[model samples]
Target: MAEIPANSLRFHVQRLPGHGAGPAVVFLHGLVVDNLSSFYCTLAVPVARAGHEAVLYDLRGHGRTERPRTGYDPGTAVRDLAALLAALRLDGHPVHLIGNSYGGTLALHAALARPDLVAGLVLIEPPLGGDWVANMIDTLSVAALGLEDGTLHSELTTLRRRKAARLAATADALLNRTSLIDDIAASRPFTPEDYGRLETPVLAVFGEHSELLPGARELARHAPHATVRILPGLGHDVLQGGTEALRHAVLERLGAVAAV
Candidate 1:
């Protein structure tokens, strides 16, 4: 992971240059539970192997990046992304954006805000409704505020107390950044009106068994250039088990988009 200074903050970014002359693909990880390393370990290798550059980064306060109390919101995140890409000299390049969950949301907002910077987008299960928005925020707030009766507290306590095992605890602590979650929950939902304006080609991948699949399908339906790829026997972590298959699927979609 390489730490780059941008937008008055520091972020940990992972970049893998591809063998070919294709445009680079930038990856964005899911919520507090996932980071750039997770994507690097799971997906970036395949992208790199496919002769495409892959870049992954940890959001503010998530991984090795410096965490700030404020400016974790979406607008700030979008600006931060623009600044980071500019710092990396990817601002005007036709770069592919791969966002998982919250990261996906960030990608959408970024693409909307900076269309010329995005060549294509791959969104993996972004929350689609107000209910999810509220619940996620509530959960994160409960944790950040250190509420004993909240889910975050209970989960963190379990993780720390060894009742949840050390690996699980590490995962929780690594993935669950209270500030990020709260920021999302406090944010608004993506209305249908939002999709009609998106010009980028989007590949929406969702787990067949994931609760968010229906929303993902709805999003694909609305996006004129969107398509859905469902991974059977998988939930939120669809890319976890059938990694090779997922990588092939992603490469295929990216290739198809490049052809068009």
Candidate 2:
């Protein structure tokens, strides 16, 4: 685990050094209120044990990374990813990508921008569809200003209030970055055409109970080379549920690459 500086942003990362040359898997975290440390604490070791280096980082405003006044756009996120990979000197190595929710969306953009830098992708329950996508982005803005005006989190219990308060604060900062909101709004979900262009192996995992099940199914249909698996009784946070099952499923997906 280490902290690396890239221009104005400081990325908190975890690297599992490998013995021989191998593809490095970088994890992109969801838009959570906590820092990147939360993700590393959960994913790094498991992924590392699977025969690849697992790298995870905090986004610009979340986690240990600095909360800049601006530059939270998805384009900036992609640039940050490229910068970090270059800083780590993993630019030439085959890259495995994993992202969830907003992070998954950013991962898609990064992979599209640097196909040669990517070997495989694992997208877990990305919210990419319908009015819900745009609505969620807009809700961030509303929730942000609403917090100040007392339109958010005024009616919850103590614990719930604390949680909502944190989310509200994060939303406030994220909403100020208009570039990010605009980029997110303009970005379309990966289409069948987009999947057709991606020859790299992919594993698209979804919680059987995820609300995005419909979208995940649609995405899988287009990804001819990708495997779509639904973990039974799992929700959005499959990582927290059924670890052994999750590990087995991930191993199954990477078995093809492991053979190579």
Candidate 3:
């Protein structure tokens, strides 16, 4: 684990260096309360072992990355990613992106903004509509209130949960004290025209019961070269519950790209 200066902020980055040949694969995790640890533990090592350089980074205001009071919008997130990749000397190469949840939305935005820099995409249960932001804000607001009133702390302590309590505190600070919710609400959702214009290959994975299934279907309709996979008995947390399936889908996509 190391910190790299990108977009004038320090970003915690982890790299699993592979043989100098295969395409570089970068993992982008979900929104607040999430970090690079999930991908680092589940997919990064496997991808590196598969002969591809795997890179994982904590998004700004998440994990060990610097948390500024502002700049949590999708546009800023995209810029941060561009700067990070450039700082890592990955600007000249086409990289594969694997994004989970909100991270997937950022990946799509990045690919649309700069097609030459992205070779392919693997989006896991990506929420597309603008309503998601509103929903998230409401949910986080409730959680923050619970944390503030001691209800959440009491429950966690009663259950002997240390990590959960710590995470809850962190989430509360990020949601209630920062501009995260506002930034997300202010973000521009991609129009159908945007999706229709993408020529990059996309592999979209959705849980069978996920609310974002419509987004996956819409993506397939717009992106001509997209492949959609729905995992059975799963929901929004496909990255956690469907790890093996996600890994296989990612490897297969990478292999197909390499063969091309």
Best-fitting candidate, scored by TM-score: 3
lDDT of 2 by residue, 186-228 (tens): 6566666776677777777888888877767776777667778
lDDT of 2: 0.71
- Minimum summed lDDT over a 10-residue window in model 1 is located at 163-172
Candidate 2's TM-score reads 0.84
In order, what lDDT does every prediction score? 0.76, 0.71, 0.87
Model 1 clashing residue pairs (backbone): 32-175, 33-175
Off by over 4 Å in 3: 149-160
Put the candidates in TM-score order, highest first: 3, 1, 2
**Least well predicted 10-residue stretch by lDDT in candidate 2:** 150-159
**Residue 95 C-alpha lDDT in model 1:** 88
On a 0 to 100 scale, what is the lDDT of residue 17 in model 2?
61
Model 1, span 1-260: residue lDDT tens: 67899999989998888897777899887765466877886789888988888988888767667767667778888888888999999876778998888788889888888888889998877766547777676766565455322455467566676534433443345335335555665677777778778899888778888888767866776777778888888887766765776787789987887787
RMSD of 2: 3.2
TM-score of 1: 0.85
The number of clashing residue pairs in model 3 is 0
Better of 1 and 2 by lDDT: 1
Winning candidate number (lDDT): 3
